[model samples]
Every structure is written in C-alpha cells, then in structure tokens.
Target: MQTKKYTRLMLASTLVLAAHAGWASDEGTLTMGTSVNYSSGKYGTQTSTDITSIPLNVAYDKGPWTFKVSVPYIRITGPSDVVVGVGKTSATTSTVRTASGLGDVVTAATYNFYNNAEAQFGADVTGKIKFGTADSAKGLGTGENDYSVILDVYKKVNQLTFFGGIGYTALGSSAAIPLRNVFSLTAGSVFKMDEKNNAGFAYDYRQKSSATSAAQSELTAFYVHKFDKSWKTQTYLLKGFSDGSPDWGAGVSVGYAF
Candidate 1:
C-alpha cells in the first residue's frame, strides 16, 4: 500500500517536471558512464559484493536552475542478504548469488538560492527522488522509493573550491525491515592543478538505515581530468570507517558534454 502511494506521487511529480523540461530553452547534456565497485565486510559482516554498472544520465542547466536524471543498469554478485540491509547469515558454505537488472532511477532539481561573484560564494537547494526500479526479488535494492532535500554551500578562492552540504533522507520501508529517516552530512574541497586536472577529497557521514545497523562514515579522494571541452574522466577511492559502510572501494567514470 505504501509503495503504491509513493508510485502514484512519483508519477505525478514526474509529469509536472517533464512539462517544465519541455519548456526549457537550452539544450540538455547527455552522459554515459560505466564503473565497477567491489566491497568486503559490508554492514559489519564478512561478506563481499561486486557490482558493475552502466549509468545513463541527462542534465539541463539554465540560469540558476539545474535538473538531472540518472538510470543505471547493474550487475551484482554476492549473497542476497548482503544487498537487502541484512548481514551475512553464515561464515561458511554461503553460496554466492548473482543478480543483474536495472538499478534505481534518480531525479534531482537544484536552484541556486544565493550567489556573490565578488566573494565567490554560492548556495543551492536541491531536491531528489530515488525510484525503486531494481527488482526486490533479486535483492538488488530495497524495493522502495526514497526522497531527499539538501542545502549546499560553496566558496571559491583562486584555484580552490570548498563545498559542504547537509541533507535528510526519507527511506521507504520494506516488508523485511522498516527503515528510519536519516540525516547526512558532507564536506569537501577541490584544487584545480591546471586546466586539465583537478583533485579533491571529501568526508561523508550518514545515519543508520536500520534499527540494528551502525551509522556510516567514509572518506573519499577523487581525481578528475578533462580531455577537451566535451570529454572528461574521473576516478575515486573510498575508505569506510563503520560497519554499515564498505571497507574500501574504487571506481572510474568517463563523461561527455555537449
């Protein structure tokens, strides 16, 4: 019943947003990317999950408003329990299961609420929705929708940019477990080394999703390079600090803009 209600709301919201997209003046950009991630000891358990995903994303930016959407095809190899917010059930003889299908779809809209050119400061308000498109039977996702609102602020000084954000997520409940709404925080800074290269690091903290789960904390370092005005690539390494997070992971993505 809750899922159905959320589905209806999502559809209505999509229609309204699509209407706005249709009236937008600028041409939107489309990006395609693929990445692979491997993790061990997730959710404080001795289990591993490996995923290779291809994401298709589209974004439109005009004036101070930006709208974006992403849909990803994911292939997962691991125990089903590991993917569904449940820890490993056994230390031995736990057969590895593989699932491949569409992952969740996400939509976001952001408005620049404040900006100061001289001070090189700006703030944005963003709203996001994550639709449960992955199959629950395959244990690829929670099979419920999620909504989030975030406030982001950034300041630029010379070749360095600093950013931070705070957000709250309303996680949808599933039959197996009821998830709690959680708050999240992130802070990061990027340094532009030259016209083609940049590096940055970020720290993220997220509240626990389940009653018995630990909160999540992770640190990430990323490098980005631009081949030209239309092509770019980025790579990142992450280290998790809590049982609810992956031990370590890495991924790279290539993007194109027009």
Candidate 2:
C-alpha cells in the first residue's frame, strides 16, 4: 500500500511537470528551490529535542494563476513522547528516538480573483493538499491526508507591499492522535530595499489541534537577494511563541527561475 501511494504521488508530480514544461511561455515562469531548516524544543517540554528538514519545491506562475508542489525529507531526533500533531509527550524517558524519511508531498493551486495593476492591489484564493507520503511507522507523518483553503490579499505602495491571509485546515487523524480542524491567520509587509534586495516580516497564528494543547503563534523575518534575473537566495529566522511550535528556527534557500 505504501509503495502504491508513493508511486501515485510521483506519477502525479511528473505529469504536472510535463504539462507545465510544454505549456510554459514568456508569460509563464518556473522556479525551483531547495531549503534546509533546523529547530529544537518540542511543545512546552524542556527536553532537548530537534528536527531537521530539507525540502525541494517547484512552482509555476502564469497570468493570474500559480501552482506549487513540495517534497520534503525530514529527520526527528527526540523522545517518542513528543507526539505528532499534538506536539507533546508525557513520557519522561531519557532515551531519544530518531526517525528519518520522506516527510509529506504538498501541492497547491492559486487563482487571482481580483487584480488592479494601476492600483497595485490584488486578491487570490488557494487550495492545497497534503499527501501522506511519509512512513507512518517511522513517525515521520500521520499516514493521513489533509486539506486547506486560504484567501490572500496584497497591496503595493511605492517600494513596500502589505499582505494578509486567513485559512482553515482539516487536519487528518491517526491512531495515536485525534486532531480538530484549525484556523490560521497571517499578516505581514515587505519592503523592497533596492532592485536586488527585499525584506519582510510576518506573524502567524493557528488554533490548537487538540483541546489540551495551546494554540500556536510565531513571528518570522525573511530577506531575499536576487543574484540575477534567474537566480535568488532567501533566508529566514523564526521565533515561536507557544508550546505547539519550535522555540527557534532558521533556514536558507536558493532558487532558480526560468
């Protein structure tokens, strides 16, 4: 069953790539990126737990639509008490558990419903799917699929852009943990420092997945530098404000567009 699931995911990804490659034009752009991230502290536990993940992303944009897909490989080193989804464990064992494998396959499609080039404002809706590609036995994922929908709006004024969004996610349930549907909100602004440099900050809040768990909140600052018309690099730092999130995290990514 696992083999079949992976095979289907790969096939779907390949088909999307092929379709985009054939349809790409001057009006459309394709971008590829890779990122690595590390974070420590599980839930509210003072335990020394950490997670590392490396993800590969592909995105395509054309006209008023955008499509994205991501595949991640992740490693978790910590006590098994750190339950997935709930983000907390009651066990006090000093023995750490390590798990590594493909994490999850995510795909999204966005359609711009409104745009005003002269006014520099636009709104879009995105639908996303999270496939359970990770090995459940390895504790990489919950072996269940999730879905979400988000609405985003942005406006540009001079060199600064303001954006915000809200979304609802239908969390998948596993034998080990039961999750509830959650709502999330994000708000931020970005400033273009020059032709090649940009900086932004965002705050995110999410409802708790379980009644016993606290809601999650985080703040992130990001910077992007364009190496050329076709290449760019991005880096970010994150600080979590709730037990359901990592205490601190950082990552860097390089992207190429064509």
TM-score of each: 0.82, 0.86
lDDT of 2 by residue, 58-115 (tens): 8887866778888888788776666443465343454568988888888988777777
Where's the lowest-lDDT run of ten residues in candidate 1? 1-10
Give Cα distance to truth, residue 52, candidate 1, Å: 3.0
Candidate 2 — which residues are off by over 4 angstroms?
1-26, 83-86, 89-95
Give stretches of model 1 more than 4 Å off.
1-38, 84-95
lDDT of all the models against the reference? 0.63, 0.68
Against the correct fold, how does model 1 do in TM-score? 0.82
Candidate 1 on 90-199: residue-level lDDT in tens?
A: 23444578898887787888777777777777777789898888787786677888899988777777878778778898988866656788887877777779888878
- Tell me model 2's lDDT, rounded to 2 decimals: 0.68
